[model samples]
Target: MKDAKLSNVFAYQNITHKDVFLSQKKYLSLFLNTIMNLESLKQLFLYHGCDKIYVKILSANDNSKNQVYLSGSYDVLNIFPISEIVADSSGDWKKERFKASVKFSWITDEGKITDAPNSQFILYPKYPEVRFSGFLQKSHNAPSELMSKRLPGRLLFMSVSNSGKILGYVSSPESEVTQSFNSLKHLEVAGVFKVLELELKINYRELLLKELFRIHSLGWITSKRLHKSGNILPCVSSNCGGYTLEAELGISANGYSEPDYLGYEIKQFKANSFDRIANEVITLMTPEPTGGIYVDKGVGNFIKSYGYEDKSGKEDRLNIGGIHKSGVRQPLTGLTLQLIGFDTETFKIRNASGSISLIDGNGNEASSWSFTSLIKHWNKKHNQACYVPSKSVKVPLQKYLYGNKVLLGNGTDFQLFLKQMLLGNIYYDPGIKMEFVSSSKPVIKRRSQFRIKSGNLTNLYKQSEIVDLLKI
Candidate 1:
């Protein structure tokens, strides 16, 4: 047997030390008596290689028999990215299955983490919520006492790692974790998640604001970006404002969809003044088409079919740029934007195959974004987004000065994005063009943007806060 580890630990990885494994009862006792507060629980999750720790307060309706209801809405998808869902034929009911490579475990008081191989996260698109099944099957030291009965208020914690694997822990109904859950339930994080933030004795909001103030103190900064190799490079593009902000924050974009800094997505947009922070159009997303002639035939062919000559009279160049709003026909492309299989009255998706499509005069789908495809990029990036306005000057070189008045938005839902699309607040404005058209292999730049004006920015989030750095 390995050396016996301590029953109580205040550090992050004290519970992770290899020790003589105790029985399930002793582990339960340790878990109940030890300092297993929310912060320590988060530390334990960190020790087990998880960055995104999502804890849910289990209700009476949430049980092993009930398949452990995750959420009633698309809130689950916002935190943890659930991949594309395909029809499941082996099931008795009409259901869909997706790729969830989660390896779950039940951590014991004996400092033992046992794996549950049969656990699965199921998604019912018809109800639009995710449920967990096959849990508690063939697992050692599993929490059968609370899970077997109809017990509410039990806390279920799922910790997702950088590799997309999930480690799970369920707290007893009468434990310290439960007590923390009840007291901190009022301060749950954005979406269906219930998190108790005792880290550094500073809440996430304060931490984010503190960092922003530090960044603002530095007046005009040179346009530069952080390389993945831990180096800084001179940035000279229209996107230099955002790139400079990220570089100042020391955020090296290694091609991950994680937040910019301190769990907040930093959005720096160009503006004339600080008062008109959201006056300019903000690009919500720029995902390529999942289906239609844009994907089936080719980008080149799609540009040739729908693209028009450059209005500036540039030779051998074709461009497709215009505002394509809901149910409106774009004159340049002659394509009308349509929403398929969505109930506008109910503001819900009636069909999983629904799409935000651009249709040609002949009713052919010129470009399309399926509901599943859009869900892949929606809400996963910015649950808590910080919008900073900046003014650029290009006299000697391009330099930007960030504004003191900043807007912070929290709690985004995919359906809310769709609702904005239906309300004509969100529209597709593509800057797709083909240069060197006379050459054998022409150069194509496809920028399919779904943008919204600054005035209507509050419609996308559940909460919005404007903070002035000059005061704080």
Candidate 2:
């Protein structure tokens, strides 16, 4: 009768005697809370037209603990056709009340409604006081090692809040789980609200790392951004500062130097690898994150799309160079190698000079420069690879060879030059199948292209070419 549109009715079904009866007590309390209050009371009675209504009793351990839970079905019976119940002077109210009479019955041992209770109240509509109990559990915890990234392993816990918020969390050397069954075991004797894992103040970063370390057995990645002032924050750089490996959260390998990484100084780390440095920077900073680190997928794609000289109608912008031992020259302009998906092929020599090349199965070429006579004479004495091919194909003996071309160069090699191109490293399992198309062409087709999407360097957790490391 309150507001038909806003009000909802609940009905009970699945009345099985086998089910535990104690669970229904909570539902009964919730319903009373909604509809029982004196300020909103309304009631009416009838004698003749009311049909029979039935109530069932279930067995509890003791009669004092007994109760019947009412749902929306009771609302329909208690407050329908409100006009019939209002005590107006008009005779229509009296006539309507008489029309609403109903017979009452109770279920007995034989499961039949044998009789009704003797007393029944006939009255004007009014509400009653609603009383209920059993609120949820809320707790919090605090961690001391939040500022320092030095956890031995992962931890997990479960927590509940006074406002009925329940959270299951994991704290690892990376991320942690807090306030669950496992965490509860250690604090069983503590008061209802004082459990450590259930407490909410624990350092979530350490918690997550603890969980990650439990699973990975390695440390979580600790990347830091070096700001201008050089003050090391627990999180990554907020401004234009570059990223540095705070510590090897988990990854380890042979000969890998565990250098003390002071966060990125944009000036010192100008290499293209800075983009990945930014991504790991943001992931560690935000909690309950909405989005991810902004990356120029299109820029990488654009370079891949327009960057090379492809007979297949698409060019590879990032290419590897190949300089041959015989000193045969290839023109530098349209001569970039296809390195995007190559595995066995890698960059061996990225020299101090701007000229760059690849070392695939096909012989190498000084793919960025044009030949000069001084370079041709110089290559014979130095025992280096062939010189860069001339702009236009010319006599064989006059062609320039490597190591001498940079000595007589008129200007610095083009940063955007095809030879000084960036390289995209593609790593795969050792058994990955790959084949060279031809000596003249630098294309290696893999057995499957499915691995390409995930093989991008950005998706890679760590990257280093065999060329980047020192010989030691």
Candidate 3:
């Protein structure tokens, strides 16, 4: 007798047609009808140790009237059992069959392991015959039904069986289907999916171009409108053009878990404008220093020693700003921003004399981060960032309206940024602003700013990916 356990076939050699001996004419006919499909036949062959098999349907009345089907060398088919017989019909020993849901597993040419559930099939005890039944037709519209259940990746194939029950359903995975399902789920929870499938499929440069086209389609958006309701406007920010391209690209207004649009940060500014970036300076994030002379001195003592009088009429403020070139003294604090632990002439960072360290009001030393740490943080926040340039036109009744023409910056070079900072193309402009109330002690606010020329932005980034907004 053939091995009853289907899994055992994988260990043995090929089995012939005679090996699949079935009894009873009704059972034989049912088995033949079910294995008519290639999928079902492939499953049967895989389980029966047959590289090549010929299935013959024998009639109980006449063996000469039997039919046959052949399956060629079967290395491409992969079949695996999912479940065992759960329950069976009551005590009728003469007629009984076991049912199971099967699963298919295969490794793609790309080496990706894909496993999916197949439909139900029956195993008869009287014979080595198994009947494959297609999935029940839950609905006539396959896409609509699968979409409703958020299983868009599942491809369902349905047909009416001889008994009129819907037969056959197979699910195939497509990246687009998965993306659509994820997008739909995001929309349901967050009320929006920031990027469409087309947007996600393209490269970062193409995505930026698409966003520029979308912005241009808006025609002219006024600065006043953009500033007053900047969150809703297509422009960046009223003060500096913050949300322009990002808003146009349908990104969430607030900073959250992910990047602005399709894993890329969108930064927009006017073309040829001196002050393109909204913030005058960029802050490099770092952990607080644990132990040092500065830490022992504390914030109050450090300020007392290095603090300079402010021209704004405040009692005393330690304001550090302006361009501090390598080996040159800063105008205000007479200190230079230097790279530590490396040679300045050859490396991006170098240590300098009289480097000032900061301490918070809570007496904790504010640690300075290395260029590597800063670059890592920046790249994490913006794996890909697009810098867009726009043209502004003045209007009589309305505020300035931006033109459709826009330029895009492809990618950023963190090493180049560090080099620029060392070369004085970027400057450290730290400041402290004090606010006083009726009877309360003055509120001291500190800020760390690294300023750079708006025109020098191109030097900090790689080649541009320019796309005409008017032409899309």
> Pick by lDDT: which candidate is best?
1
Candidate order (TM-score): 1, 3, 2
| Model 1 lDDT at residue 148 | 72
TM-score of each: 0.81, 0.14, 0.43
CA RMSD of each candidate after superposition: 6.6, 32.6, 24.0
Q: Write the per-residue lDDT of candidate 3 for residues 1-472, one digit (tens) a residue.
A: 1222122232232433344344123333544565233334233333322222211221122111121111111100111122433224344533444454544232222212233334444443333234443322232322222223333234322222112122223333454323333334332110111211210012445555655665666766554322323345433334334444444455435534234564456655555442344322333322333233325665444444444667676553444344555446555555545444333455322221112233333433333444333433444444355555555555442323344444344344344555676676766665544443223465555555555654565665555543445666
Off by over 4 Å in 1: 1-43, 49-60, 81-103, 108-110, 116-128, 137-155, 160-164, 171-194, 197-202, 253-255
The residue-by-residue lDDT of candidate 1 on 84-179, one tens digit each, is 444343433344343332366776544467877777666565566778776688988878777777888788887665445566778877888778
Summed backbone clashes in each candidate are: 1, 74, 11
- Worst 10-residue lDDT window for candidate 1 reads 1-10
Show model 3 residue runs off by greater than 4 Å.
1-200, 217-240, 252-258, 270-307, 312-318, 348-367, 390-407, 410-413, 437-440, 465-468
Give the Å shift of residue 173 in candidate 1: 4.6
Report the C-alpha displacement of residue 399, candidate 2, in angstroms: 53
What lDDT would candidate 2 get against the real structure?
A: 0.21
